[model samples]
Target: MELIVDATPTATVIRVMATRIDAPTALQFKEDMRAITAGFDGRIILDLANVEFIDSSGLGAVVASMKQLRPDQSLELAALQPIVEKVFRLTRMDTIFAIHASADHACAAGNT
Candidate 1:
């Protein structure tokens, strides 16, 4: 479970280096997210470009991650592949999280 954490001016970008966020990696995902997000501030962008598939557990882990953040802090998602984007849309999670087309777009300085 490799996560590349990039601290940008507008948001902290956590890029998941792994390919799948499924039953096998869900627990590790939550644990690692908790570790990295500790005391973090501002908006957080989860880069999911490499994640091709996500199961129910994976979705649950994502929700848990968002919940763990401070209420004032925001958790956005970026670079979702087709399958994963479909999953979020199908589950009506797209309405819950800010979904971006790409990481670069998410990090754009003027974005709010």
Candidate 2:
């Protein structure tokens, strides 16, 4: 899993480099996310712009990543492709996480 980690004063933006987040990549995704978010103090924006698909396991991994975060920190998802977004909607996960139109929008929304 190749994750482009961008660190800003506002948030650590992690852009997924993979096209599909299916069962095969779910475990690696979790590990990468855990390692990526090990010490950040600001908001965490998961930029899924390039991700075109996500399976149930992938969704579970994303949810688990959120649960693993420290109490003071938050995880927001951004730039979800249509297919991926549909899965989130079908699973009612859109209600659980703050979804943004784009990574820039999420960054512009707040720094804290």
Q: How accurate is candidate 2 locally (lDDT)?
A: 0.93
* Candidate 1 deviant stretches above 4 angstroms: 109-112
Error of 2 at 82 (Å): 0.7
Which digits, one per residue and each the tens of the lDDT, describe model 2 over residues 17-74? 9998889999999999998898786689999999998999999999999999998889
Worst 10 residues of 2 by lDDT: 103-112
Name model 2 segments beyond 4 Å from true. Answer: none
Q: List all candidate RMSDs to the true structure.
A: 1.2, 1.2
Cα-based lDDT for every prediction: 0.93, 0.93
Please give each candidate's TM-score: 0.95, 0.96
Q: Please state the error at residue 53 of candidate 1 in Å.
A: 0.4
The all-Cα superposition gives candidate 2 an RMSD in Å to the true structure of 1.2
Query: Model 2 compared with the native: what TM-score?
Result: 0.96
Compared with the true structure, the alpha-carbon lDDT of candidate 1 equals 0.93
Cα lDDT for residue 27, candidate 2: 97
Candidate 1 lDDT over residue span 67-102, tens digit each: 999877889999999999999999999999999999
